[model samples]
Target chain A: MSGKYKDVAYYPGCALEGTGHAYNRSTKEVGKALGLKITELKNWNCCGAMEVKNVDPKLQTYLSARNLSIAEEMGYKTVMAPCNGCYHNLKKAEYDLAHDQNSREVTDRLSRKAGHKTYEAGKVETIHALDWIKEEIGEEGLKARVKNSLNGLKIANYYGCMYTRPRHIFPEKDQGPGSESTSKPHFMDDLLAAAGAENVDYPLKTACCGGAHTLSDSDTSTKLVLNLLTTAEACGADVIATECPTCHTGLEMHQARAEKVFGRKTKVKILYFTQLLGMALGLSARKVGVQENFSDSMDLLRERGLY
Target chain B: MPIHEKSLIRPENLVTHEHLEIEGVDVSGHWSTFINTRAVSDYNEQMQEEIAALPGGEYIHRCWQCGSCTNACTVNAINPDFNPRYWIYLIRMGYESELLRDKDIIWQCVSCNKCTYACPRDVFPEGVMKATAHWLELKGHTEKKPSMVFDETFSEQVFATGKIEDGRVLREFFARTKQSLFQDWLIAMVRSLLMRLPVTLMMKLGLATVFHPRTRGWSKAQAAIDEYVHEREAAARKALRLDVQGAE
Candidate 1:
């Protein structure tokens, strides 16, 4: 392994501090277990999740540029974001600043007015949490470090829409075998497999959960999430491991909504991939903030003898 | 010859006669279906340019109607009426009256970007959907959708404070949208979490709602963003010719 990602700046965004507390907690726990260091960018602002882009795409670019500037100011060349939305936006900001002149001009104006150094492209590289672990600690490393293996826990790794859509933002992916594939993302699957989980051949890995309008259009979100849940179950997956907090909560909330509103009940439990990895590393369920998750998977963990 | 893809023809345009003889031939029932021909004269020639002026619609001109966007659309799979390809075609053709037929559902595009990933022509149909939805609202064809309201509520928090508290955003959204906060599934989800959550974490979450998260020294950035947004809003209005009409 390159060991380049041993220490990096972390940007959790707003969702992690609120609805995605479990993902935030589990990610840090996994990092600690892996002996990697993630320093939180000091006084970081929001990355303008899916909502702000609707207001103005340029504004969203500015928001992410500000965060990248903070990372650069902290003397870090690589910043890791666990949230797919944060990661995507940061990568998007980096791409736009490099390719689009208008984007660079607007970001420069906003930074000048915001009283911070403008974040030029190539100042800092942004990597997702999956890349942080996969590149630094590969499957072999993880296998060697496994304390309590996942032990054949059937998992469907759900990457969701933002992680690999409109593919221009992530230039590093799809560069052959070792690099991540935008079409069929296997970083999560590989990591969970290294933890001894059985990676199911799930087809809807990159499906949209209608997360952008999850609350605004509940029925659509419910339908989309139900499809993911049923497909995972059809693939014989007992758990749907998610990397994005939005997708994790969307699956949980819509799983409930589908049952209540549409009368379609699904039993596949959703957990953050980090939580699974942390548990595999012998961290207790409580240590990874399992109690904070909307879906109660304690019984499932117990049944799998993972606790 | 019968029109191709008869399912796409509007019901009002499809005419069928049960018992009729046309030109001495017994063309009755299933054989007597004819599509009504009509002229579309109310084409808003400015529609394409207006939408193109919006952020996402900039690439509308690049579309060659490959139908990859519709085939890859997540919303279109669930709701057949949510067709980005057809909408792009209508927008390019300036079929304003035809486009108005699906204005209500345009905002349901969900911003999936599957269309973008699948498009070979770089159409970015997902952005076109957003721009069309925005155009519909700006031109007073439809009211501000719940999605727009939620976007505004979530964004206003970020624009004002550098961060947003999930609880406040939810509460304000429900209040603004007039949706009851006591949604069954929401309550059930909350109850499940409460049952499992530690009291310390629960208290921490409760405190976050009271004292919402804010980035330190964010007022300058907020001011800069607000200024940029106001300027862009004015430009959008000017582009849509809304300012001349004194429209909001």
Candidate 2:
């Protein structure tokens, strides 16, 4: 709108505020480089996620609306969420407030608790931070930051189901519309493309990597992980990449289970968006928070001759 | 090098929210309280929901059921038998056993929030979906949700050294899980009998191992972590500057 978001509105949600801080960290860095400013939403709270909105869809709508409405009143029109979950919740609130009168009424009631603030649903544009970065930075801009590129990379663009699905919040086209969909218009894919990655056709791009299920149902989660690795292996992908911390955990942490299932040694690795981004930018592993991973990305890089 | 020929098949239903009823999955009642409330008194109530869910989720009230969650869900996208939308809906009703029983599907939420993104209602279904997994784990449900397994070790690692010692965390996690990675297995087996620890202990416990690495100045790191966490908490409070009329 202003050429670039000189002052971008940021919502880290609760998880990103805490353990999932790395996403926020990477996003801020990348956004800043692209001339998009990242400003923390004042008095922002959790989206009541990790709880079932299906239990009380109204409450989910209400709380999420209240947060966004607050942002609207603060004069912020663009809501940037690093967490796909947050992005969905915030965007959904906006959409609900727009179409459902009941939701608006309830949101108004919730606004009472805001100590005297009101929210209008459509007052903001909610998008994953990645979407805007690609728009602003473009391939040329990203190429400028390239001190290094992923050469000879057998990189897999593991969308992990979040990047392209739930097309309501994201542009419908981003989902690569139609049943015969192959490569999604996934921003992560674009990001990988910018990094000079050769995207392997990963079937589990939208497949569940066994999120919290890994904790509640290890055997099941293990199977899910097993499937993911097997799928990536089938695609001949040397490494997998993603944007969410939870997704990262599911794919990497479940490696042991995968090994147990196949009864063979496994060597696949999982990484955060920044880890791969850093590699593509010719940055060192530590700069992209590589040491924090369970499986080393270096080994994969070396094996692929990308290092 | 493999050539990844881009498919002409369009990705039409990516997390497309279609109303679904996963038969055989049992749970009666709808989770409408979180959404119907209209308004919360303040931010803490909202955060309370997130923290309580912890390792699982913070976006409990975000689902508007476009089937985007189910559609985008890795498990569902791959295996419709495991639907996140249905699992989360069950959670909305506080259907504990229903969620616990699937044990596998409940843990299968994959934390991507594609459903959350597409709901058109911003109902981060993934948060509560994950939280349900945590709730299952807290209740001593043996089902190991992918992210929840890290919860205990992540917390313990934090408490033990004020910072995460990845090596220790990983080793501790495997030990607790009963999976012995070579040497770590032998140590866990020996420790298992030596401690006379009950089987319930093994419920969260696993085979022991020294596979995880530890830091040299863990005590300093621990203190720093505690101090930082406290400071962050204090800062949050300072930011809220709460105007409480009644401290019930």
Query: Which structure among the candidates has the greatest lDDT?
Result: 1
Lowest lDDT sum, 10 consecutive residues, model 2 chain A, at: A174-183
DockQ of 1: 0.81
| lDDT of each residue in B75-187, candidate 2, tens digit only | 57566667777765555544444445477556555555566665566666665665555455444566554344556555545335323433354466667876665643234
Best by DockQ: 1
Backbone clashes in model 2: 88
Clashes of each: 0, 88
| Candidate 1 docking class | high
All DockQ scores: 0.81, 0.10
Error of 2 at B18 (Å): 51
Error of 1 at A139 (Å): 0.5
| Residue range A39-147, candidate 1, lDDT tens digits | 9999998888998988889999999999999999999999999999999999999999999999999999999999999999999999999999999999999999999
